[model samples]
Target chain A: MRNVKGPEIKSVEDLIGPLARVRPGRPGGEVSGTGARTLLASVTAEEPTGRTAGDVPVPAAVRRYGLRRLTLGAAAVVLAAGFVVGPSLLEDGSGGAASYANSAVAIEREGGDYVARIKDPFAEREEFGEAFAALGLKVGLNLSPASPGAVGEIFRVGTSGGGVGRGFVAGTEPSGCSPSEPGCVMVLRVPADFTGEAWIELGRQARPGEAYRNHGSAVGRYGELRGTDVDGRPVEEVLAEVRRRGLQVEFQRIIVGDGGSLSFEAVTAGEVGPAWTVWDAEAAMAGKVRLMVTPEKLDDNPMYEPGLGPGGLDDLGESDEPGKSGEPGRSGGG
Target chain B: MSDDRPARFEAVYREAYGRITAYAARRCDSPQDAADVVAETFAVAWRRVDELPKGQEAVLWLYGVARNVLANHRRGETLRRARSAGLDAEMADLYAAPADRGVEMSVIAEVFRNLSEDDRELLSLVAWEGLEREEIATMMGLSRNAVRIRLHRARRRFSRALAAAGVPFGMERRMVPAGRSL
Candidate 1:
C-alpha cells in the first residue's frame, strides 16, 4: 500500500481528530442518586438502622446471593464479607467508626478496612503517635507550619509497604477540605494487614504574614513550572543555581515507560531559602509547580484507586509497631 | 441546615452524572455494562467524596476513577451489583444510535483503532476531551513533560497509521494547520 501523506497535525488535539469524531456518547442527564446514596451509606453507615431512606442493611446472605448470582466463583468469601461489613457500618448510621476528640482522631471499620479520619488538624504529632500506638495500626499525617501562600495546603503525601496506602487528595487542596475552604481533615485507609504508617505532610494554616517553608512539587519529565523564578529559565539553569547555592540535589530516574526523561525533584531539609521562594512564586504563576522537594520524603504517593482502600481485609488488630517499617519522619528532604 | 454526606454527595452526583454516564456509555459494550460502570464509579466517588477534587477538577478526577472501574469490570474484578438497575434504565435511553456522528470519520476510526490502548487514550484525551497537556498530566498523574512527549509520539503513530490506511493527503493535511507535519 502506497503511504499517503498524513494530516499535518499541529497539536495533540488535531492528531486524533477522526477518533474524536467517531467517539460515541455525549453527556446524558439521567444519572440517578441511587448509586451515590448507596455508596455513601456503605462508607459512612451514618443513618439509623434500616430506617433511613438511604441506609440499607447489606446482609451477608444478600452479598453471598449477589456473589453467587454473578458466579465470580473465586473471591466469594471476600465479596461476601465486603457486602456484610461495608453496608453494615452504615446500617446503624452512627456507630462503628470510633472518634477521639482529644487527638481529633476517628477510627471506623468499613468494608473490613479501618479508615482513620483526622478530625483535628491542630492535634499534636505525638497525639497521632499515641492514637496509632493505642490502636496498634499506624497511620501518619505530618502537619507542619506552612508558608503564608500554602496555609492549609497538603504539600506532599507519602505511603509505603504493601496493603497500607494513602487517600488521593485532589489538586493542591488537603484530603477533606474544599479548595476555597480553610482547614484540612485527613482521611487515610489502612489495609487490614498493613502494620505501618502512611505519612502525609499538611500545611497548617499560617497567621497572616507568617513565613513558612513549602514542600517541593513532584515534577514528571517535561513538566513545566511557571512563576517569575522559573518562567523562562531552562531546567539546567535551575539545577545549576541550586547547586551553586551549596544545596543538595537528587534525581530519580524514570523506571517506567520509555525512560525518555528523568524525574526532576529538588528540596531543602530546613526552611526554603529566599532562592527557592523565587522559583515557587514563578512556578505557581504558570500552574502547580513540579519540583517534588520536601523537608523529607516520608512516603511515595500511593496509587489509590476508587473506593476505599483495603476494604475487604479483617485481621488487623492492636499489633505492636512493626519495627518502624514505614516511618515517614526518617525519610529526609525539604 | 447544610447537607450532610448524602446531600453533599448528591450535589457532586448531579454535577458529574452526565459526563460520567457518557464516559461509561461510550466505553462499555452494553447498557448493562455501562450501568455497572456508572454505578460502581459513583459508589467509589461517594465513598471518597471527602478526598474528591473540588470544582471542574472533580469531573476530570472522576474520569480517572471511572477508568479504573471500567478496567475492573472488563477484568471481571467486580461483582455485578443489583444497584446498577437505575443506571441500566438510564443508559438504555442513551443506547440509541449516535446520529451519523462518525460517518465521515469511519476510516479514521479504523486507523485509530489499530493503535495501542495508551496511545488511543492519550489522543482521545486531547481530541475527545480537549484537555491540554497540563490537564492531561494531572488527570493521568503524570508529569506534563511525559504527557507532551507521549502525546507527540501518539500523534506521529496515528499519522503513520492513517497514511498506511491510504487516506487522502489533502484530507489528512486538512486537519493539521498549515506548516505542520507528522
Candidate 2:
C-alpha cells in the first residue's frame, strides 16, 4: 500500500526549521533551586484571587468591538491593496464598555479618558493594533528592542506621519507595570472626547551590551527644502523665500572645480550671505543648494534624503565617497 | 482543587520545563532572561492552577502563557527583580550565550531579520514552535482562516526575499488547498 502524505513541506519552513531544533540548553542541575522555591512560596503566599487564563466571560463589548474590528480589517485591506479609503468611510462612533480585557491589553474608563493597560508590551505589533482597533480608535503602540538604558522605557512620544490627532503624549506609567516586573503593563490614556488615528513608540530593552540598531534619524527636525526645482533656484532667491517665511538662513556655496568636480565652502558674502558665491560663478551653475536654513542653528545636522548621501549631503557624515559634500556647514574646498 | 494545584503544577512543570526553556532560550539574549521567562510562566501557572486543562492541553496553554511572558520580557519590563538567589542561580544555569552561526546561517538569519516582525513571528511559530495553523490561531488570538492566509502570505514573502537575496531554497505549492481558498 502506498503511504498517503500531508501537504508538502514549504521552502520557508525548511529554512527556519533548524532554528527551532538547535536551541541553547540551560545549564543542568537540580530544578528545585532557591529561585524555584522562592517563586513557589510567593505564589503560595499571595492570595489567589483573579480570573483564570482565558476564563473571562465574553462581555457585551464584543458586539461593539465586532463592528469596529470589521471596519479596521476592511481599512487595513484597502490600505494594503494600495487603494486609498477616505477617512469618512472609516469613521466609527465611540461608546465601548468602561472595562475591556485581552491577553495583550486591558482598557478601563478613567476620568474622561480611557486607560489602556498594556498587559504584554512585547506582544506582536498586530496584537497591539487589534487591541486599539477594538476600542474604536486609530491608535497604535510600537515596542521594539532598545539599549539597556532605554529598555522598557518610554523614550519619546509624539505624533507620527498622517496620524489621527494632535496633543497625544505619554501619560504616567501604570502602577502595576514596574520596570522590574515580568510582563510589565503600561497604561496609556487617550482623550475621552478624542478619537482618531494615533501611534506611540515604546522600547524593549535588549540584553546588556547587545548590539541594538537605532533606525531613528534627526531628519526633518525643523523643516526641509529639497527637490530639483528647489536646488536649481538661485541662492539669493531661496534665501529671500526663507526670509519671507521669517526664518534664519545659512547658505553654503557649492563650488565647482575647474576640473568639473563639486565642492562646498561657507558663503562668506556679508551682503548675499557667503563669499564663495561671489568668487565662484561656476558654483551657482553646478547647483543652487540650500544647505541649511532653520529658525535657529541646529545642534546636529538636519536629516536629509538617503539619495542625497551619494552626493555627500546627508547631515550625518555616513558616506565616504569622493565628490560628496563634507560635514554639514563645513565645505569640501574646491 | 487547592490540594491538587501543587502536584498538577509540578507534573506539568517537569514535562514541559525543557520545552519552555528552549522556547525562551531561542528567543532571549541571555540565560537569565530565559530563566526569568520560565520562572514567571510557572509562577503564573501555579497561581492559576485551577484553570489549566488536562493532558497535552495544559502544555499548550503553558506555551501560550510563556509566549506572553517572553513578549513582556522582551519589551524590557522587568517583573520581580528580586527573584530568590537560588532561582537566579538556577536561571543562570540555563544561560548559554549564543555562538556565532557561521556564514550561511548568518546570511539566512540576516534575511530573516529583514522580514517584517509579523512575518518573522508567523514563520517562527511554524518553524520554531512547530505549531499547526489552528494551534497558532489559538495562541495568536486569530481565526484559523486568518492563520492560514497569513502563513501563506508570509511564506510567499519569505520566498521572494530569499530569491532576491540569491539564496537557493525549495519551492512549495503556491496555491492554497481547495477548502482553504481565501
Candidate 3:
C-alpha cells in the first residue's frame, strides 16, 4: 500500500495479486482455412427461419441470426450499455464474481410494499444515490478499480475515507474527454449512518454475451490461460481465483450444440473490478485475459444456444445448408 | 537495449496484450481506439527498446509511451468540455454517479464541471486512469504533492455532488423504473 512507485509489472502484480483461475475450457484452437470458410459460410444466414439448425433456413430466421456474424456486431452490444436495456444486462458479479466479465448487477428487491431497484455498474458512483432515490434505499458504492503492486496502498486509499460508501465520493475532472463523453457515469451516496433498505439494478444489453469485450473486439471468448506471467506475477492461480471469486451465475439454460461447444465464463471478484486496478499488461498484462467471443447472446434473445443453430425458431427461413447459424465462421452438422 | 528490444517486445507483448488492451479499452473511447493505443505503444517500444533502461525502469518507459499516446489522442480529438485555465476554486458540488463501470462517471463530470480543462487532466491522470501521482504531476507540469492534494479535493467535490443531486441516496431501488429512460 505504500507509495513505492514500483516497476509496472511489480505494480500490476500487486494490483491483481494473481489472476483468479480460469474456468475449465480450451481457450484457443486451430482456426484452419476450412474453419474460417465454414465460419464465413455459417454466418451467411441472411434471414430468420425459426426452424432450428436441422431444418431449412427460413428467410426470417436467417435475417434474425445474420446480425451475429457482422464484424463489430459483438462490441456493438456491449457498448449498447451506453444505450439499450434488458434484465439480462443487470447481472452484477461482485463479492468475487470475476468470471462474468464486464457484467453489471441489477436486482429488484422487495422493500416493504415498494420494489427497490438496486444496481451496481461498479463504474459510476452517483447511480448509487439515484438507485437510492428510485427505490428509497440506502446505497453502498464500492469503488474498486482493478490495480496492481499497490494493492495494500490502494486498499488503504479505498478504505481511506473509512469504508466504501462511508466516505464521500471522489470527483474526477475529465482529463481528455468531455462530461458528455462515455465514461461520464456519476456517483451518488447517502450517509453510512442513514437507515433504509438498499437495492441495486445492474444490467447491460445482452447483445454481446457471444463475445465479452476482451482486447478491443468481442473475439475475446477464449479463456483459461494457466501458467502465464502477467506483469511480473504468476497467473496459474488465477484460474482458481476466478472460481473462488466468481459469482454464482445461472444461465436460463445450458446447451451444447450438435458439435459439442459451449462458452462458459469463469470469474473472480464481484464486478466492481478488484480491490484495486493495475494499469499494466504492457509490463505484463495484468487484469487482462484472453477469451473466445462466440456467437451466443444471453437470455434476452430468443433462439437456441450456439449448439442449437441459427435456424431454430423457424421464424427465419433457414435450410439444412450447414452454414446458417447466423454465427460468423462456424461449422454446421445436421 | 536496442539489441534486446525484440526479446523484450515479444515478452511484453505476449504477456501484456490482453490486460493492456483492457486498460486501453477502459481509458480510450472505443475498442478500436484502445487497440490502436496498445498496438502503437508496443510499436514505439519495438523501435526504442534499447533506450528503455533495464528491469522496472523499462516499465516506466512503457508508461511514458502510453501517457504520450493518450495525451496525443486527447489533443487530437479537440472536444474538451471545459476550456482555458484557473481552478483554485474549492471544487465543491462534485457528484459521482455510479453510471456503468459500476461507478457513476457522470458525477465526475458534474463535480469537475467547474474545473478548468487542465485540472481535469491533472486529477484524472491519477484518480481515474490509475497513474501514479508523480507521473500525473510530470505529465501536467505540476508539483507532486500539489497534484495529490488537488486530486484529493477533487474526490471530495465529487462526493458532494452525490449529496446535492441526492441521486445515490434512495434512487437506487427504482433504477430505470417504469417511467424513466432505460
Q: What share of the true interface contacts does each candidate keep?
A: 0.19, 0.11, 0.00
lDDT of 3 by residue, A200-261 (tens): 22121112123221111101111122212211112223223334434122111223444644
- List where candidate 2 sits over 4 angstroms from the true fold: A1-10, A20-47, A51-334, B77-100, B171-182
**TM-scores, one per candidate:** 0.41, 0.37, 0.27
Best by lDDT: 2
lDDT of 3 by residue, B1-182 (tens): 33454456555544444434444544564446665676556555544444544443344355556656766676655554244222312232242222342334344245455555455444444333345543443333333324433543444344455457543432332222111000
Q: Write the per-residue lDDT of candidate 1 for residues A77-128, one digit (tens) a residue.
A: 1211212221112322433333232345665555655556666656788766
Cα lDDT, model 1, residue B107: 67
Show where candidate 1 strays beyond 4 Å.
A1-9, A22-99, A103-115, A119-124, A138-140, A144-180, A191-334, B1-111, B130-156, B159-182
Docking class of 3: incorrect
DockQ result, candidate 1? 0.16
* Candidate that beats the other on DockQ, 1 or 3, i.e. the better one: 1
Give the range where candidate 1 chain A is weakest over 10 consecutive residues by summed lDDT.
A62-71
- Deviation of model 2 at A204, angstroms: 48
Tens digit per residue, CA lDDT, model 2, A196-275: 45556554544433322221111111122211112223345545444444534334444433433434545443634321
lDDT of residue A146 for candidate 3:
18
Looking at model 1, residue A249 earns an lDDT score of: 42
User: Candidates ranked by TM-score, best first?
Assistant: 1, 2, 3
